[model samples]
Target: MASKGEVHVVHLYPLQMSIYGDLGNTRTVTARLARHGYTPVLHRHHPGDPFPEKAHLVLGGGGQDSGQARVQDDLAVIAGRLRELADAGTPMLMICGMYQLFGNAFVTVDGDHLPGVGILDVTTHANAKRMVGPVVLTTDFGEVVGYENHSGATRLGAGQAAFGRVRSGCGNNGDDGSEGARTGNVFGSYLHGPILPANHALADALLSYAVPLATGRPFEPAALDDAIADQARTRQIRRLVG
Candidate 1:
């Protein structure tokens, strides 16, 4: 497979949504892309900036409710462009706060309504107690794991499909076994182990979709040693499962 000369990676609201090592996902993606012989170009899209004209993979991180409020209007400003990208099969990974905003709306405890981009068929409400802990999930990528700390209970719509099923810990909502929302290649989850570092499959899948879209070249992955990450992931999974 031919390598893409470059893949544009867009990171939204990095400064505001850097909670719980969320920025690690961006770092991990770039690092992994390098190993695959592709140059990863990063573009940071803050509130009011024009959405990058070039984007292969888009990422967003976790943040507090307050942070979400701060980005609410800004997200609205770029929602249309994001929706367009999603429809075009540009891979997107939205965690926690971003995940909530990508939904229909996020209802605060005070009955305040924060509108969302409606990319995912889901809604979040601040009613359930905070669910914070390590999580293990059964997904199409096999076993995926991460950490989640959020009080905003999310519910997937009837027409929606979950990103994975929770095997342990609260996911989406305390009542549902679902862990995240999925619309085409757009994925929304609360996982925060900088997520990509702990889940290689997810990261690689995003890159596979990205290279072709960005440079019209198929993604040819190289075999890189992930022994350290694999070992760490194994220990965490064991601790959680045990």
Candidate 2:
């Protein structure tokens, strides 16, 4: 994996809509990379603009239902390019709303089925209660802490998961089995906190996936302090779940 200094992380579709602290995910990712003395170029992409090429890492954040609807068309326009990049091994991390949109289609509350990018074999439907709370995810990489806030029910397809058992909270797929959707190096999750601040392990995995292409060296993940924030965030989640 390339060192952080050599990697470029782009925020896909940040302008029109942003849900939860999705933007925070971008900040967290860049911050972690910076700690290793790697300067990550964070690029924000919007609708109708040309996506940068051969990016090491790509990020997609959550947004409101209406915003999702509004962006669907724009996303469709660049869907081919995005898929091509993913197929070519460019790592992508998509959250909640963006995660669902990567599927074949989304069944909105109004019974409207909107077209999706179809990069993954998955489907999402609106649920009654908006799932909102902290989540504990366990994966081959390691455990991750983040929040889930959405009314979408996701069903994993043939595609792999970014992580194993979600362990806690109602994830986007409405199941507790996995953290998010993944295809090749692409990852999709409902951890609205952008999943970087508290989940160093997952962040490293993402970096690992991208940096290899940018630089030939293996990734050297920096240590993160989980103890400092554990009590506060865990207590809040425990209270919410209870």
Candidate 3:
């Protein structure tokens, strides 16, 4: 357990996974926490490691197909603990391959089914062609932009709340307008480019959940200057729209 004023963050599979610049997401979380005066104590977990005793926030990132396969068995071992954390309102941000593995299962193009943690009520089908490009989403937090590169087409189960509606680019699938899935404090998205840097509101929202959980009281983080991030987001949006 974290001491008061400190947040325990679990970074899962940082070594075997995180093929796509996904490790940057962990940096963003820590930076945001620092700006808000909370000390973020990171617990990095690799395959075969014991699950952390407590975590106010958990982060898992995208990986290549091979990387995904490498961590599947290890992930399954901790699936029950993850589900319990989600149910208990711990905040999580799972990206790309991790997002797929958070669901019921991910069916590969070769017709093999990779068992998932089943934290999200969704299923992913690996397609031959990848969906790679900038994506815009109109989420409850507002507009968010990021880059996506994945071949998994995920379909949400009944009663699943999408993280947002697609504003541009291929989302969960080229067909569905949904871009990601969210249940309580758990967020699963395909967006990369180290998602939080461009999506300040979403970052703050995650912090809002974590701070309260860590400190046992509500917290409203002080605003920080996001000028550079906002400028980059605008340029990306323009390029995607134009």
Output the number of the lDDT-best candidate.
1
Tens digit per residue, CA lDDT, model 1, 91-158? 99999999999999999999999999999999999965989999998988878899999999999998
* Models sorted by lDDT, best on top: 1, 3, 2
After superposition, the stretches of candidate 2 with alpha carbons farther than 4 Å from their true spots are 1-4, 158-162, 173-176, 222-242
- Candidate 2 per-residue lDDT over residues 1-242, each given as its tens digit: 44445678888778655667788878877877777657688888888778776578888888888889888888988899888888988888788888888888889889999888987677888888777877876666655677788888888776445445766776655554666777788878888665776666677778877777777677766776667556655665566554
Write candidate 3's Cα lDDT for 1-242 as tens digits: 33339899999999877878988889998988888778889999899999999899999999888988999988989988999999999999999999999999999989999999988899999887789998988899878999899989999999999988888988998887998899899999999998998888899889889988898888757668999999988888787765
**Superposition error at 9 for model 1 (Å):** 0.4
lDDT for 39 (candidate 2)? 68
TM per candidate comes to 0.97, 0.86, 0.96
Q: Which residue segments of model 1 deviate by more than 4 Å?
A: 1-3
Worst lDDT run of 10 residues, candidate 1, spans 1-10
Candidate 3 clash total? 0
Indicate whether candidate 1 or candidate 2 has the larger TM-score: 1
By summed lDDT, the worst window of 10 consecutive residues in model 3 runs over: 1-10
Candidate 1 clashing pairs? none
